[model samples]
Target: MRILFEDSPDYEMVLGDYLERIPISWSRDESFGLLKTRLVAEPETTRDLAEKVMDNREKGGELAGSLLSAIAETSEGQDWMFESLTSGNVRKEASALVMLLNLISSITEPNLDHNLRLLKANAQSVSEDNTHLLLWCLEEACEKERDIFVPLLEEVLRTRGVPAASVYLSRPSLHRERPVSALVLAVEILEEKGLDNGEISLGLIGIYPKNREFVLERLKRWISKGKFPDSHHGMLVAHLKKHDTSPIIALIEELIDSGNRNALYVAANCLEELTQSISEWLGWCEKWESDSNKEPAVIRSLLEILSRLKTYEASGDRIRAIELVQKFASRSNIDYEDSTKHISLGKYSHEGCANTRQENRYTLKRP
Candidate 1:
């Protein structure tokens, strides 16, 4: 609950000002959060207020969904959803239906059948005017339940052709892979538009499993920009998980060779879960060590990775890690040390570090 101070300005006045001015604002989503805070005070009338929000959810373009999506989470807002959908205002209906699609696919209840039936019925009636909203709804729904929405998606693509496919291709999300056919269409769209178009390469659609290596040549800079296991890094991680192959390993190997400490950390972090065998990891270590001019921070991070590696009993497993530890055991690379102690030249009483006898000793960080 918000604490309303006597000295504070009136929420009702503030709400009225926001509701009136926001439609004409240069940016709608900017102050939407403040509007959301004030919006709950009068949920009884939120349906009427939300009708205005839904208007912008349509005409206000992509960013406007911020408020519209938030309002959908409110009980009163949801109660008014079907009313707005069948209210004969195409814009409001489409906006409301997209949120309905988001909810039905993402959450389930006993009455979910009723929602699905209504969704399909309204979806069938979607015309060219509603195609934009239809695709918006399709992306969210299809990603969650391919069995249900892919047919609808396919039908839309069949009817609308490349123009419709181009829409999805431009703004594809890395949250999950789109259907194979949709991606094929996306590839065709890019191929037709030509890779010379700079915008096409920036999309995750280009990274579809087919042209992955080709697209990575363009996206490695972005992957480098990923300093952590962030969403960009996740795209590669997810890419590997999808392919279930080691093609992306070459890319990580390249990043490790770049001699950037963050790149080393990110590359190692990305491979942490790809452990099919010890050889896979040992190969990566050798790749790092093979760089004769490797940065000390990168080497230390490598030490941390191997020292913390899950012990797999085999020839040369952890040998390079031990070798790395032994070589760096005498000198602490404090310049490159991660203050989190994530990377440090350390002497430790760990089973993995038992083989490396070091003069300068600090406890190794552990989970």
Candidate 2:
């Protein structure tokens, strides 16, 4: 383990001794075999065996849990062994550092925080290689072990600002739609450190309604900053419902008139979400549709936005929505051999628009 040697001045000698006795192959599986062998025969060689486990797992194998289980099985495999190795003591020896990371891979057992503190303490004494390895281990551990790791992560976020803060906030592993969750967790950590204020908290909370109070307060503070993007606005609607929709609606109206087609598109999308009445959003939709100079791309995007509104059961403007559907339906008037294949792209079908007369009779009674 690199971290092991980083802490011990005699790590090179220790590594040399291990290499001579341990018959580890360059391949990950072979190295794991060596560790398993050592686990059976040389119980005292826990540190070196642990290093092999780390190396083997990094060599691209699913050996982390198995290796950790083997190491943890014995009394000689001190609970703190992985911590000691990751703390930078094993830095001079690459094998040892890898072993520690591999050992803990995906198992996220308790007591990692106490061990993390030990690693942090040794960080000063360890070499740069060990220090980086230790930091990476800390980050990885923090990701899965959120309970204890959160408080520690907050401290790290407070102490290390900017890029690190952004780094801490973002989890590269997450899908695009899931990044907001990680950002929300990161905001909580930042808030604990007092490093995050209302605006930043609002941005995250707007993305995650569970963070409602923080988001609503923050949004109120920063509402003048300009209209939020569609995702954020949608999140706000969920967070505050229609209670705070008035101001956001005003902003959406301004965005629709901003002259920027992209902004207008997003504004129209927001309008589609805000008012219960589709008629209110239809004026902007009509304006966009009337713009003869508007790019085909903008029109296509607007059409898609209207299509989304048309599908909502709560939309208030059936007449305008039906009109939009008719407009788009006429444009898609290609003759078809099969009626099913002749599906139109408008807001609603002729049958559906006619059916709405009956639907609106009951819908008009909703508050």
Candidate 3:
């Protein structure tokens, strides 16, 4: 059955109307093969056909086959398009490239390999304007067709150097699903290929705004998998907000057990959200201090949490606060020396940073 514009529905009509002159038919399947044929043929209708397909995909719910194929046609010499896309000559053309890149991503590879090839080839082109867009497409490609695209992108990264790939590595949607694998691989590439810390941090944070549970799940997986060690500190801390008490508590306890000083600092800083009552705060301080025998990090993290929560938790029942903190802190060495002394230091310490003196005072002054 021939698909005609007038007879077909709006989605098919718009696409058909735009590509009327192109000598192509839209089959539900095999659009990729056709696009490959047309790309090799170098037909003048190629870009128009690609644009129409994207238009249909963007507006219609489903992406067009031919448009997807155009992205997949990865033969040599197609690198020029990446460069052409970045030039200011025709905004329409550039926009069409972006549209095609955005729309074609929905099609799963081996169909995606075509666009990946184009991106890999053009990744190093001197097109600063369209660079971010291309990187975004690569990020999506990594998500949709990870097996096919990651190696290619990695190779492209190695060739151009890891710094160039920072943009692609950090795209958020790429991390919307199980991002641990990508983050691990990305951290490896940055370290092995010599990317700077700034670049790595930027990419890591790209995945940070995802849910706390999501991050926690990935963190556990990463630990189990035993990779990406040098990065999680900043990533975890950067993600901490005032409302993250549960995870912060669990993380602090874990770090204390693990004996990682840096993680301890981060975990302690995270607790700064728990400062509701002196008793509750100091009670926890006493327990952890009792168990650890003068380990400053645990005490510090507890104090920080308590100090921050002071006013927020102050109106709470004093006796209840003491019982809660005391109950929670009951398990350990229970050091109130510093926390008590620093209770009056105020929860907000400006830039002086969290220290033993503040922690000690915070614990002692809590009546």
Ranking by lDDT: 1, 3, 2
For every model shown, the clashing-pair count is 0, 23, 38
lDDT of 3 by residue, 216-270 (tens): 6544433333332345445434444424445545655675577655555444334
Q: How high is the CA lDDT of each candidate model?
A: 0.53, 0.45, 0.47
Question: How high is each candidate's TM-score?
Answer: 0.43, 0.41, 0.43
Cα lDDT tens digits for candidate 2, 158-213: 45544444454432332223234445655655656665443343446335434445
Model 2 alpha-carbon miss at residue 37, Å: 13
Superposed by TM-score, candidate 3 places the C-alpha of residue 347 at a distance from the truth, in angstroms, of 25
What is the lDDT for 341 in model 1?
Answer: 44
In the range 1-367, model 1's lDDT, one tens digit per residue, is: 5533121235334433444455322122465555555545655444444444444333532222333444555676566567656777666665566556545544443445556666667775665666766776676667656788788777776677656666665554545556766655554565665432323443444455665655556445544665334543444445455565465556666775776555555665555544455566555556555465443434655656666654523325455555555445434454223343464425545654544322122333333
Q: Which segments of candidate 2 are over 4 A away from where they belong? A: 1-50, 53-66, 79-151, 172-207, 213-265, 271-302, 305-367
Question: For candidate 3, what is the TM-score?
Answer: 0.43
